[model samples]
Target: MSLLFLLVAWSATVLSCALLCRAALAAARALPPAPEAAGDIAPDPAAADRHASGLTLYEMAYLSGGPHRLADVVLVLMAQKRRLLLADTGWATVVDPVGTDAVERAALTAIGPEGQRHIPAVRDALVGDAAVRRVADRLETQGLAQPAAVRPGIGGAVRLVKGSALVTLLSAVATYWTAAPGADSGQVLIWFTVPQILTLGLWAVARFELHPYSDWATVAGERRLPATTGSRDAPDAPGTPPGSLITLALRGPTALTDPSLRAALHSSGA
Candidate 1:
């Protein structure tokens, strides 16, 4: 009877946890997009033309939030004529462009055998954006520096697994206590403690997976470009011919951090 009770309790705990995780994920998916700050630059018109011409480049920088500090840069190249969007980042791309630039920059910077080739045109185009400049300035003023690349740590994972084990063990203990003697008074305490421990353990695992990193430097310097009207469709849109190319060279950190620059990258399908 005692063994059966333990088995049942364990099953219930596992089921409950699974349901909780599913619910949490669903809630997260339903969340509204992050609020955009005032004065945020809209996507650039030039990006559309560039995209149509199969000439798009993307660079992204990662910054540490807290507890762990690291940085990375990712780059992506798009070939509009070929209907190909080559992403250097580790993540799988569907249609969404969120965090795509950062991932691409990191991958490009991580290329071991390839020598650094500065593309003046790409840099110049990025520098023309206002948004990128803002972000770069904020990062520099915050004293954030490029972080050395290293393999992710296992400490966080191990701690989480141990915590999960502890929660299961505690739940089992509660079942035994309730069945063995007059322990009804402690049921609430045990239930709350189990959930709390499990929650913390899961949070640790999530943090480890989403480890923070910073980029080496911004690719462009601050510069302003006048907005112009051009093609409205995506550069890679079906049946659209390649457009004329206009390339610029960007230099300095501020250019890369500018908010306008970031917006341009997104508009260009980078």
Candidate 2:
């Protein structure tokens, strides 16, 4: 019975290890080279121009932080333009019935024709909004973001390996409990060390090498992230500087320089 337990543990460990390796390879193949790795090459002028010009602010927000971030950007921009009211208490009231872009239009639709809704509800609604989906689709089409289907593949593999590790540990305990009375249970437990070591070692390496495997951006999109890391004290108000919103998109709500803006953002969904 002890030997049988060892066999089962070994089989699971080996299978999981193989799966881990395969997942890592698949993830590596799916991703383009790291952004910095391509620095030596010259960019195509027309392609670079399109890349710079075609990407809108809302799309940048999505690339930085997905749907919620895009929603935040729209809200902040609208508030600045006096088209919407973002109360410090987390309520959003639309002032202007018109929207400047698809994302803003979606936000308006989420708020309903009455022009009032809680900010959190708007953020949640935007997640499944067609405007957000279009942004994701366009990014994927341009090879600037990973497909939603492939994003979870490596993460799922990592979780499976973690489960396999737990099984190996339990099997070790079972081997000791099921051993013949005269047999050295410690020695039987020693057999489990092989699988345990295999699982743990691979887990550690995978954690290091594939840490950001589930992130939204592809290498190209990541490379295009704004360079501004805004100050907490930057005091950025709407229409103050273009980089202010970009900073908010990249760094999240914490980067909001206005106290009311910060409060509104945190109270909404922090």
Top model number, TM-score: 2
* Cα-based lDDT for every prediction: 0.33, 0.73
Question: Ten-residue segment with the worst summed lDDT in candidate 2?
Answer: 44-53
Q: lDDT per residue, candidate 1, 173-202, as tens digits?
A: 665666746645354445545545665665
Q: How does model 2 fare in lDDT? A: 0.73
TM-score of the candidate numbered 2?
Answer: 0.66
Candidate 2, 100: how far from true, in Å? 2.2
Residue 237's lDDT in candidate 2: 38
Show where candidate 2 strays beyond 4 Å: 1-55, 159-186, 204-209, 227-243
TM-score of each: 0.23, 0.66
Q: Looking at candidate 1, what is the lDDT of residue 235?
A: 31
| Displacement of the residue 5 alpha carbon in candidate 1, Å | 13
